[model samples]
Target: DPSHIAGKREYLYEISQKAFDMGMEGLMIESHYNPSLALSDANQQLTPADLSKLLDKLVIRYQYANNPEFENQLELLRNRIDSIDSELLEILASRAEIVRQIGKYKKEHNVTALQINRWSQLMENRIKLGEKLNLSEVLIKTFFQLIHEDSVRMQTEIMNS
Candidate 1:
């Protein structure tokens, strides 16, 4: 998570400490050099050096806890969770990029930006598929809502551009 411009490191350290005290295994943070050049979250991206410093502190604190089995379990779970999250993010990014392309095509062809009927059909099919896969209807609906909203926004941006 991002914090105010100044004291971000202190703020994050406090947060990490609190989380640790509350029995959290760890945290996930984003970092970049020359954060000003970042495409997303430019203002919040920490420098590599700063990120390393934070990690060092976290490592020391974690080791001081002296629960090797707990640490190992946390590491394994975190790695697997991160792997799944990365794959999901990749898929979403690819989908968004394709939506942008579709918007460009629509603009060049003078097509309308939205097709409500098609979207409805897509949602219905996805819901059925989710059910077949043993997913809750509510979860399926919520997921599709988020995906559809993002797709629409992406396509709209391309069309306007």
Candidate 2:
């Protein structure tokens, strides 16, 4: 598919460079002793000599941890990300706990999980807040729908159990 270009060789080189840029190990290139005489897909085949030249032109960089400065910066950033991820999980868990309690209360009152008016109110209020926070309405809707679905499933399980 990548070979579907004017210059197949150049396409391969470009693809190789992009792969390297995007933290890929390497590209799987088809090499032939003689490209023109190749039996199958000759157009997409690279001569060994050409492959060697392309390899030479490429600058393969080490992983981020190779340099101490880079490693330190990456570690700091990753640690911050880890902390943020932990906080996100904690928030979700807290929400789940509340949903669990709600399930119990609804059961006690002999109410079903599908509280349409309550769901609509929540969606409307949260969507407004999400808009104020500069979030896309579509994104907010999707996220809340997923959370609502999660709550419904968990509540159903709790109710039945």
> Per-residue lDDT of 1-161 in model 2, one digit per residue for the tens?
33444246657887777778778886777789998898876887789998889889887866565688988998899999999999999999999999999999888888998899999999999999999999999999999999999999989888888
lDDT for every model?
A: 0.77, 0.85
What TM-score does prediction 1 earn? 0.54
- Tens-place lDDT digits, model 1, residues 1-161: 32343334447766765667666675766677887787776655678998888778763244354788988998999999999999999998998888888889998998876789989899899989999999999998998889888888888888888
Candidate 1 residue-wise lDDT at 156:
81
Name the 10 consecutive residues with the lowest summed lDDT in model 1.
1-10
Clashes of each: 0, 0
TM-score of every model versus the real structure? 0.54, 0.55
Error of model 1, residue 86, in angstroms: 0.3
